[model samples]
Target: MTASASQGASSISSSSIKRDASEMNNMVTMTTRLDANATVRGRRRPPLSRRQRGNLSTLLSRRSPFSNETGSLAIGEFEPSAAPSVDGVARSSLRDARILVVGAGGLGCEILKDLAMCDGIFVDIVVMDLDTIDVTNLNRQFLFRSKDVGDSKAAVAAKFINQRCPWMNVVPYHGKIQDKDASFYRQFKVVISGLDNVEARSITSENPIPTLLLPNRWLNGMINNLVEFDDDGDPLPETIIPLIDGGTEGFSGQSRLILPRITSCFECSLDAFAPSAAVPLCTIAETPRIPEHCIAYAYVLQWPREFPDRKLDADSSGDMKWVYERALERAEKFGIGGVTYMLTLGVVKNIIPAVASTNAIVSAVCVNEAMKALSFCSQSLNTYMMYMGSEGIYSHTFVYEQKQNCPVCTTTTHHMSVSSIMTLNSLLQQLCDGEFRLKAPSVTSSMKTLYMRKPVALEKVTRVNLDKPLKDLMTSGEELVVTDPVFPDTSLRLVVKFTDVDE
Candidate 1:
């Protein structure tokens, strides 16, 4: 049957009253008599039976779940009599689930609102954010206002949900989650990422907790769902993976739900750019460097030198240089514009609110997918990408089959061996500590070793070993170069290149 037809049929079935024509007529008569009489006289009111009282209560107390003043029980507190049959898996899935949101930004605000208002799912939300409301955030973040500036986002968001649905217990954590330990994070059944940095993403992904990483890209967005299994236990395999498609690239957005394990995990969708792929620092504007001119201009124009008390002694001159350098570094790191010498260069445009709104919508799609996963109604199993432009919306869904020799998943039994998993974990820890190094060789023979300080960006290219043969060096795929030198004593820096590898 068509979905709309089936929905209409269900509605009709649910709304069908069990009362017969005589019972309905009696109810109407009673209602008319009650409306006409200022006080009941002639006959005494009939005592209502338990069943009759229940029917009357059901009719009179039926309130919309989204209503603010509704006396309906809060989520997670449904009465046993109202619970669905235990035999139905779909109804059982959402009975009691704890959802932890790690940010109170634009995306977090929208997801919280939707989860609170939308029916069919029972969710207990815990909001965590270290930031307070800023005037700049008022443009796209919906839950905050000018008056809310400097107020805790988590607290404000929680109050917003409580006012809408008092039954919901929206807990707010007004502290940074970066320093939170794994034990502290275990309270959540699922973790949703609404953060804006690679460090936070990596930390959340590595967490043993089931985590959903929703990062917005230039045009398309990515959702990474990481599921960790118990050491000796196996649960039911994921059945329906919905292919998620849609995101605002230029103007509009599109989304599809994909089932993983049954279809493809975010990593299997693309041979190279998996959902866990690290975004380049340039993409997120984390490693912005100030222009030399800006540094020089700041020093020459803004440096205080006229006041006798503020005279530039040797120490003061060094401090001024340090301040100028620090300011330049910050400007570059945050991708902000450098200090301009000319004030009349025209006003710099702010990041568009529409763009931020688009991001929020895209993030909402990820949250929706999580809700579907929790509610046990996922359908599609493929990678879905959406192209939202000023002109129109375009979407594409592709099923990614596991490569027979996939180093990460395929050749090794679909499950990582304990030792291998431990090794990978160690490597990740090293990467996190900034002790590990990633190198990519350049096309030119002179620029062989590119020392990557951080995994997110290609920073400096230094020639460490000039005498080594370029072709004989061991390499992985064209995009990745692995160096395991045979001679331990020899200080030979190996060369690797970043080349695209076919799946």
Candidate 2:
């Protein structure tokens, strides 16, 4: 061999030696752990009986076997007859409980597995996801496999879980969460979401209108929309269900429990979620600094101009390739680097990188909260938990306060004072640009429709109202029911007070 070839062979040999040494160390650690586990197993207490395990009080009273105390049970006995029952009808167990899980992704898969395996109870579950499985999903979405690509994520995940736990019934809904109405949501005692998208979590039919005035996106609009209120401004008991939400990005994640009207809902803590970063058009079109800038340029400027009649579907391989090529060309021209197909897809689709470990941690917390909410075995996370593994393993559980003037939870009517001379278009603009940050909202008075953005015919009729003054539409102190596409089933009651001044 040549001198350089011999040197390369020596380097490979060194690397192989190091790899072998590392493997040996790992084996030693594993063997040590196994030996310790065997010793502990020898002294392990017998498994608790089904009756004792299902009893919340009994489970709580059981002390740890590893404790220095003499006995494992507080009373040193099992009372089968004392097991809790549901009003003398049936046993108080989660086996009969129905749960709805939305988004059969990474966190969803872990949640389903954990819930099915939890306490050996096979709780009936409903899993929903509109997305189809992709090869990319197999890495973290453990329920799917290479062969399962191109199948519905919800269906595949449900099938896997059902096969693994035959007693557990997992029904899959292969459609958008928005497709389901309030009646469908009322069937579940708890709703757990492992969705990555904010809009999907909120189940918004359309994107919130973009505005610089609001820095945060809409909160769990799904709960607000699903919940119904009585005449006294109290939530209908049947409509209120605990929502356990989990989200993960990189090494960080959070799990939050929302109780409609009672505790803070998703929208109550809107400021916590940072809005998607918006790159200035000037930067994208003129001075490209990063790969994202190039991607945006291709998506925002080039895509429409090139394909005027065809919409750019982010999920379409053809469309994504076209955009990627264009972005590559732009990056090359501007001497920019790091423009990959994945990066382009992420930029166009607005996807965050999901970590499996983070998903698992957050989903476990979510399912635990759900159990607590339903079984009353322990106090529910009061009502938020945050996890950060980027620095070190860190977790915090705390209460998220409810907003008094929240547009969704409370019946507090927002007072909007406008000049009589202000045109309907100006009022609409204010609603879009003001603190409310509503997009494409339809306005209705007590008897007539002032303006509507849908039902093509109705929108055409109300188009003329845009130029009409507020005074011409309604009187002072007239209440207007404002509904936005972002919040389909919920309406914001805005009491419009017309004043003579330009204020």
**Which candidate should be chosen as best, given lDDT against the real structure?**
2
Q: Model 2 over residues 1-503: C-alpha lDDT tens digits?
A: 99999999999999999999999999999997876675444774455688776644454334333222232111112222243443221223556678999889888999999888765443589999888987567789999988898899999999998898886789999987767777777788888888763421111113222332121123256666667789987778667788888888889898987877788876667556554444556667899888888888887789889999988887688999999999999999999999999988776765568888898889889888776666544455767788999979899988789988878667689998889989989998898656665768889999799999889999999999989998899988889999885564778899998778443
Candidate 1 wrongly placed segments (more than 4 Å): 1-95, 184-187, 197-360, 378-381, 400-503
Worst 10 residues of 2 by lDDT: 200-209
Q: Model 2 Cα displacement at 489 (Å)?
A: 3.4
Residue 247, model 1: lDDT of 32
Model 2, residue 317: displacement in angstroms? 6.3
How well does each candidate superpose onto the true structure, as a TM-score? 0.43, 0.75
Name the top TM-score candidate.
Answer: 2
lDDT of 2: 0.75
Candidate 2 structure, TM-score to reference: 0.75
